[model samples]
Target: MFVSQPQYEFPFPPDLEQPGSQHWRMVELTLHAPWFLLTVEIFDAEMLDCSMSRTICIAWDYDLAEVLRGLDPETVLGIVCMMPAWASPNGQWSSKEVREVWMCSSPAGQSVLLVDPAGEEFDCGLVPEHVEPLKKDLVLRVAPAKPRRRPHSRRKTPPTGNRRSRRASARKSEA
Candidate 1:
């Protein structure tokens, strides 16, 4: 007796067949890149002024690296972030801590721990050009937020010399 197996089919809807959908998937991938690199400089206690601790930081992001290279020296140099919101834990895209990017030939090869400006460490993965599309998305996604202007304070006129003060002045003159 011969037994036949039932055939199952997945409906490939028209949406899945479109090129735009494929591009969308590509863009979505950039949001979650798997490769990064961490280039850490030697730690200096005098420069850090905090409790005496020796720690070096590293960072890596393909898009982030390109962005850092393009940023003005004034933007990255000597900029101290008070409260850094990490992208790994906090999922915040706007981070001043990503100082530079280091590209590698593999996505999951040599790995190192990266310490953010906030002093939090995480393993950074470096990848080659396998995910260029995602880098574009990263650039667009991590654009700096526009500076918010503080509300101006209106100048308050001192209560036109109060009546009591005026009267006192007049009496002083008469005396």
Candidate 2:
């Protein structure tokens, strides 16, 4: 029951750096204005690694912004998950990743994500040399809305014919 990995590279490629292959299950992402709900089926091993690894740690996907506020280490390594809701009105979204530090379970043993504002741009080389970037946990590329249902969803029958004409049609049916 052992595995071989390089101290877990943060922002690593899902196809490779993962403890195992990236098992992105069908997670349901519901964006309810101001907040979002994520039902992710993250691999159990990944979750265990979050707390078991002595040299590696997995942070929530909302702390990347805060890290910017603090003094970044000259040389550090880690992976960060991006928020899926930081999209702008123009439809442009942040390509940079986000990391969050949450207090889960009384003592804090979880790494769930929280929404964050995308006010800064990520340097081509954001993380330290040791760190790498992974694909978004839930990358939502929202394009412009296409043509909707014909006449819109609120289709209404035009007011055709006069009131007496309508009565004649009803009488014909009665006969």
Across residues 1-175, which tens digit of lDDT does each residue of candidate 1 receive? Answer: 1122333223357764755422121112122333332222233557753222212122234333454445442223221122223434566443334322233333434222234445554333332335322321111111222332223635354345652211000000111
**Model 2: how far residue 171 lies from native, Å:** 85
Off-target runs (Cα >4 Å) in candidate 1 are 1-27, 34-60, 76-114, 127-175
lDDT of 1: 0.30
For every model shown, what is its TM-score relative to the native structure? 0.25, 0.19
TM-score of structure candidate 1: 0.25
Per-residue CA lDDT of model 2 for 59-100, tens digit only, reads: 322333233224222112223333334443445433333222
Find the 10 residues in a row with the least total lDDT in model 1.
Answer: 166-175
User: What is the lDDT for 149 in model 2?
Assistant: 36
**Candidates' C-alpha lDDT:** 0.30, 0.28
RMSD of 2: 24.5
Q: What lDDT does candidate 1 reach at residue 171?
A: 8
After superposition on all CA atoms, what RMSD does each candidate show versus the true structure?
24.4, 24.5
User: Clashing residue pairs in candidate 1, if any?
Assistant: 35-125, 36-125, 36-126, 38-59
